[model samples]
Target: MKVAIVHDELVRRGGAEQVVLDMHKAYPEADIFTLCYNKDKTYEEFKKARIFTSWFQYLGKSEKLIKILYFPFAILAMRMFNLKGYDVVLISTTHCGKFVRVDKNASVITYCHTPFRLAWRPFSYAIVNSSNMIIRNIFLFASRVLRVFDSMAAKASDFYLTNSKEVKARIEDSYHPEQPVSIINPAAKLDNFYISNEVKDYHLVVSRLEDYKMVDLVVKAFNQTPEKKLVIVGTGSMEAELKALAGDNITFLKAQSAAQLAKLYANCKALIFPQHEDYGITPLEAAASGRPVIAFGKGGVTETMVPYNGDSARCTSVFFEEQTVESLSAAIEKAEMLQFSPGFIRNHANLFSASNFIAKLKTFVSRIYNLKTDTDFYMSLTEKVVYARKEVA
Candidate 1:
């Protein structure tokens, strides 16, 4: 069957982009469709695919400018896509990519990372950090209009999939999806990561330095504790501002390749995740390296990390109750005190392998399209579910 993949944009790399890459791997022949495509800014692997871009790609040369123009142009640009002949259109989006018009015969399978945050939550970081009152007002007005467009787009999909139950619940409450949302947590590249016997004193934070991510709070937490070291691996608009806020002990590295990141993950004392994400892939990567996490105790991180609940041996993470510097610092201190089993943590991570994710995704597509199943893969998954239930009983 002919397949096409649609994504919001390809301006920068993130968990959403990784999902698109994974989908491309599953459907190697699938052509990619998007609002914008930046060959320099995104993954190099995308160069292998036949990428179709909307007019938004010509709007700007800089990623910053592209992002600024995105919201206004996204819906219209996605609607302009001519995805007529494909048998399956797999939409991977947080925003307007779902607005793409497809043939009635084709099945639209949407993997919603999250509903558009700005559209649903107007007083969010985007509005507050706009700086210009006129721009903020324009954005606020646009959000109200986009919310309606977003809902209409949601209705176009034949099936829904998401990264976490957190996002699954959000999709149901926000879009009121016709079909039940399937949770397929994004996987870690287990082949690239491994545990190290010699761990260093430093902690790690691997995220885009965005306002909503709360990286500044982490910098503050580490600033107060000069004895602790932090290695931040990412670049964004806030890079300069975050560097100014960070102390001498904090080391900032531009985003590394997966192999380099594996080394960082294995050697770090723990990974610090401050954002309330849909489902964080970094924490899982850290777990794959057998390192524990120090995280804000909310959002999807809670679902992934095995938090300390009187048993240090069983936990793979330490959660801070609040987003404050004091709370996060305390969690960091608590994490240092805890003794966790590296082998056990790696075992937990093995359940969310890339192969497993692809298996589930293939099964979903097969079932949806009424195609023949891979009997061995299907039976293995069924047996595991049944065994899990038996364990609970």
Candidate 2:
């Protein structure tokens, strides 16, 4: 059967892009369709894929500029994506990629990262960081207009899958679709991470330095506690402002290579995840490195983090109920005091490995398409052979 994958844009190697990579891994033969592609910003593996881009590809490789100037065109481009010959179309999106026009007979499966965050909560969205009122207002108005199209596109899909229960709830509330949404957690490359018992004195915050990510809040929290050092690893629009806010104890590093990141994850006292992510992969990455997480006790982190109280040995994280600096500071203190088993943390992370994600995704797709996967065929053969032997006996 012919399968096609649709993604919003190949802009950067973020969590959404990682999901697309996994989707490609699950169906290597599937052709990828997107609005734009920036070879410099994305993974090299994409160069080998059968990627079809829209008319917007001529708009240049600057994703930030394209997003600001040509968002409406991007939406139009997504609607224009032709998926005629494909039997199944898997759409990976946080927005309008799911709107790709497909044949009436084709089955379309949408794996939503979240129902357009800007449309649902404009204030908390990334546009909040914009200093210019004119630009922010334009985005706000555009978001409201796009929301209608987003809901319509959602209704068109045959099946809905989301990265987390939080996003699943958002999808139901936003679209109110007739079909039920399934939860499939996005995964980390487990082989890339390593566990280490000798943790260093500093806490680590590995996230985009965005307003909604609240890396600034983590910086503020660390600023108050001079005894503890905080290492922030990521680059974003908020980098300059966040650096100004940080104290001497805080260090901001540009995005690191995979090996450097893994080493940092393995040695940090705990991974500080300050944002309410849709479905965070960083916490899982840290856990795979046998490090504990200290995260805001909301959103997708709640699903991943096994919070430590006095009694639970299985806990992989410590939670801060509020998003304020005070709450985060207290949580950090508690995290520092508590002890977590490295083996248990690594084992918990293994549950969300890339291999497991691919297996689950293949099973879900096979069921939806009413086709036998390789595993299913092998299992059937084994069963038939065993039955024949028993009958002969």
Candidate 3:
């Protein structure tokens, strides 16, 4: 079957980008369509795939520049892409790429990271956080206009899938699509991470330094606990401001290589996930590495993290009820007191491995296309045998 994969942009490597990579692995022949492609910023595997970019690719190759200067134009450009001959179009998007026009007969399955945050939430909570009043106002006005279009795009999809139940709830509340959204959890490379009994004194936060990520809150929480060290990995627009807010206990590191990241995950006391993510991969990665997680007690982390108080034998994390520094600091203190078994944590993480993701995704796609699998073939044989036995009786 001819398939095409569409995404918002290929400018940065994140959870959404990982989803696209997994989709490509599922359908190796599929061509990738996007508004922009920055080889330096994203995974190199994308370079192996046939990537088609819109006019926005040339206008502003940088994701930041494109969003600031020509976001509306980029949305329009996405709609203009020609995806004619493909039998199926799989869209991995948090924003406008879902609006890409495709053949009416083709099956368009949109794997939404979330309904565009700007359209569904308050201006301050939007995906693009900025201090500039002019830029913020422009996005606010644009989001108001885009809400209608975003709904139309949601309705246009043949199937809707989300990374977590949290996001599925968001979709129902925001878009109210005709069909129920399926939850397909994104996964980590389990093979790369192994349980390590030895750990460093420092805590770790592996996330983009964004407003919504609440990295600054983590920094502040660590700052208050002068004895505890916090190592932050990942860079974003908020890096400089976050660094300014950080105390001596907080150490900010730019994005690390996969090898370096694995080591960091293995060595840290626990992964500090302050943000409420759609379906957080970092927590799973940490668990897979036999490390505990200290997370905000909300969003996707609730689905993956077995809280210490709830499941002592298999617990991989402790939670903070609120997003405040006090709550987080309290959680950290609690985490210090708790003991988690590395074997148990690793076993919990194995439930969400990449192999399992691919298997489930393949089954989902087969059902959509009405394709028979080996399991289905065996079931049919069993049915035939039952019919023959009844006839003989």
Candidate 4:
């Protein structure tokens, strides 16, 4: 069957974009469609696929310009997709890819990373960190407009799948989808990450330098403790702002390949996940490398990481309840004291391996394709009978 994979954009590499790459692995022949494409910014593996970009790609290649226009342009660009011949259109999206149009006979299955957080939870996003009241108010108004479109897109999709319970709840609250939202947690490629013989002194942070990600919080926390070292590996819109806030204790690295990142994870004392993610992949990656995580105890991290509760042997991470410098710093101190088993940590991460993810996704697609085939058969049979009756009369 002809298949198509859709993603919101290809400008950056994050958890959502990684999901798109995994989707491609599941359906190698499926053509990839996106709002825009930037070969330099995203994963290099996408070069193997037949990629089609919307009109937005023609506008500009600037990351800031894309970020500014993404919400408004994405909705319109999604509708402009001509996926008429594809039997299945699988969307891996956090935002507007769900609005993609296809023939009535085609099945549109959305693997929603989360509801549009910017639109649905504007107060918790970049605007919350902004000092300008005028910009905040305009953003709030724009959120309302985006929400209307987001809800419409949610209702149009035939099936819904998500990466975590946290995101499923958000999707339900935001769109109130009639169908059950299946939860398929994303995976960490255990093969790509390996345990190192020597654990380094520095803590690691692997995430996009975005406002919602709260990378700045980690930088500020590390700054307060100058003795402790931090190595942040990733870049985004907030790179400059974050760097300005960081102290000499904090070092920034551009995003790395899987092999390079694995080496970083294997050597680090522990991964620092400051953001409240939908379904965090970096924590799993850290775990796969036999490294523990010191993360804010909320969102998908709570589900993925085995938090320390007077049991260092069983725990793969130390959790801090509040998203504050003090809480994270305390957690970091606690993690330093704990003696965790590398074998146990790696075993825990094995539960969310790339093989498991690929198998589950392949099964999901097969089931959906079978149901669509049955529906088409019944529809064609009904149409044939109706024509016979018309001729008889």
Candidate 5:
């Protein structure tokens, strides 16, 4: 079957882009489409795929500019592309994933990370830190318009998929309550685990230094620890701020190769995920390296992090509630108290392996599409109910 995967911008690889990559692996024959494709700086692995781009790709050189330019480009490109030829239209979205207008006969399924924060989380750090006032204001003023378009896009879909149960609830509460929504948490490519042969003394944190990412909180929490050192990976605008705030213990790293990161993850005493993530791929990496994750108790962590119950179900990680120095300090202290068997971490991490995600996705697709089955009657009934041919394509 010919499938088409769409996203807003393919500038830098983060969690959202990984979803596209996995979708590509799932549907090798599918065409990968996006408003902008920053090919020159794209991850080497995606170089071979049939990446189709819109005119805005020329503006993809700078991600700061690309984020501002992608909205209209993505929305306008719906009129520019003929998506009717594809059998499955899977939209891996965070922002403009639901912007496209599909043919009435095409089956569109959107895996929404969340609605654009400008609409849902206007006060969140990710939205308030916009570079341009004009564009941000224009987007804010036209938020209703954007919401209508997003809703229409969702309404036009045959089904909806969410990365977490939290996200699923939000979709039901905010948009597409009538649509069939399913939960498919994002999977991790566990092979990328960076387990240094020789252990490092410092703790490691790999995240964009955004206010929402709460690297500031991590810094504050670690500042009080005094004993453990910190090595922060990834750079952002707040680098200078974080650097100045750091004491003798915290170290800032611009970036590192996958192998280097894996080594760091393996060697660190534990990975500190201060921020509440949507569906964190980093914690999985740390656990894959036989390390524990100390994170804030919010967002998707509740679903993924298994708290220690007993010998049979030991937690891969622990969570802290108050995003303050004291709370994280307590969690870190608790991490020291527990003994994590390397085998237990690897076993839990296996559940979210990329290969497992592919198998599960294929099964879901078969089940949703009502592909030939032994229970012909039930299959026929769902085929009629799910394939809203006249409603969405």
Candidate 6:
């Protein structure tokens, strides 16, 4: 099949990129496409894959801002792109991926991470911590425009898929009530984290320091636990302010390589996921390396993490009730008692192997490719207008 996979950007290797990578593996012959061809520092380190970029980059930040300001520009751009002769179009999206304006006959399935919170979430929240009113209002107005485009994109897609059930619920409520949606979780490679004999006595939080992510909450909880050490391994707007609050035991580092991060996940006492994430891949990465995750009891973690109960101890990670320092402190203390076996943790991670994800993904794509567009497809297309017209006549 001549598959065309759409993505938001090519920069910053994260969970979403891993999903795209898996699609690349499943459809090796597929021509990858995206809005921007981000100059990744480690693109060559990955296996060979054929990828393409839109000429939208030529418009520079002005077009980017326009696209961001008026989401229809993005939708129109997707419509304008000549995707003729492609059998399948898989949109691996966080924000902009759903805008694949192609022929209705083409099978398109979107793997939505979430509705863009900047667009969907309230504007009052955006202005909560911002100082400049003018910039914030501009952002707020743009976000409304973004919402309209997002809705249009969702309606345009053939089928909907979310990375988590949490997101699936959001899509139904926000985008379309009648849309068919499924949950196919994005996971990490357990084998990537090796069984290291050396133990490093520190807690790890490997995430961008975003406001919703609440990396600062982890810092606060760790500060309360002076005996425990924290090694934060990603950077964002909160970097300078967060670094200023770091104690002697907290080490703040920017983004690191896969090898370096795997080492950290393997050695840490536990991975602290203080935020309510959409679908946390880092927790699995840490568990795959024989470490338990300590997180707030909500979001995707609820789906993946079972309790470490009785003899089935290794099958789970620990959770806290609230996103407060007190709740996190108590969870940390409780986690100290839980049994963490490298073998058990590794076994738990096996359920989320890359092979399983790829297998299911291939099956889903095969169905779309084999679907009969002539008889059933034409009949359905006519049902929307032609059949109604005949009935009216």
Off by over 4 Å in 3: 69-71, 124-139, 371-393
Candidate 5 off by > 4 Å:
125-139, 194-198, 309-313, 371-393
**How many Å off is the CA of 328 in candidate 6?**
0.5
What clash pairs does model 6 have? Answer: none
Error of 5 at 21 (Å): 0.9
**TM-score (C-alpha) between model 5 and the true structure:** 0.88
In model 4, what are the clashing residue pairs, if there are any?
none
The C-alpha RMSD of each candidate to the native structure, in angstroms, is 7.8, 8.8, 8.4, 5.2, 3.7, 4.1
State in Å the error of residue 48, model 3: 1.6
Estimate, for each residue in 1-393, the C-alpha lDDT of model 4 and write its tens digit.
889999988887677777888888888999999988899888788888899999988886556776777766757776898687988889898886877777666666789887877789887764556649888888888889888777766665667899889888888898776567898888876788999999989999998888878898899998898999999998888999999999999999996777889999999999999888777889999999999999888889888889998988888999998889889889999899999988999999999987788899889878877874587663543343334223322
Model 4, runs deviating above 4 Å: 128-136, 237-247, 373-393
> Model 6: what TM-score?
0.88
**Each candidate's clash count:** 0, 0, 0, 0, 6, 0
Q: State, as a TM-score between 0 and 1, how close model 1 is to the true structure.
A: 0.89
Clashing pairs in 3: none
Looking at model 1, the pairs that clash are none
Candidate 4's TM-score reads 0.88
How do all models score by TM-score? 0.89, 0.89, 0.88, 0.88, 0.88, 0.88
Task: Write the residue-wise lDDT of candidate 1 on 219-326 in tens digits.
Answer: 999999898899999988899999998999999999788789999999999999998877888888999999999888788887788998999888889998889988
TM-score of candidate 3 on Cα atoms, chains taken together: 0.88
lDDT tens readout by residue for model 3, 1-393: 788999999998888898898898899988999999999889988989999999888787776786676457877888788788987789998887886877655667789998887677745565346447877777778778778667666666767888888889888998776556899899788888987768999999998887889998998887788898989998888999999988898898897888999999999999999987778889999999999999998989888889887555679999999999899999999888877799999999999888788888878876766532455753442343334223322
CA lDDT, candidate 3, residue 320 = 94
lDDT of each residue in 1-393, candidate 6, tens digit only:
678888866655678888888878778888877765555532552347766665654543232363453355444554456666786888887677666555555666778888777678755364634748787777778778878767665665666778888899887787773346888778686667876777788888999887778888888877777888999999877988888877778998887777888899888888898988789998888878888888888999988776555644655678888889899889888888776677777787778888888888888778666665466863453233333222322
The lDDT ranking, best first, is: 1, 4, 3, 2, 5, 6
Tens-place lDDT digits, model 2, residues 151-257 = 66666676788888888988899977556789888888889899986889899999887777889898888878887899999998899999998899998899788
Error of 1 at 174 (Å): 2.1
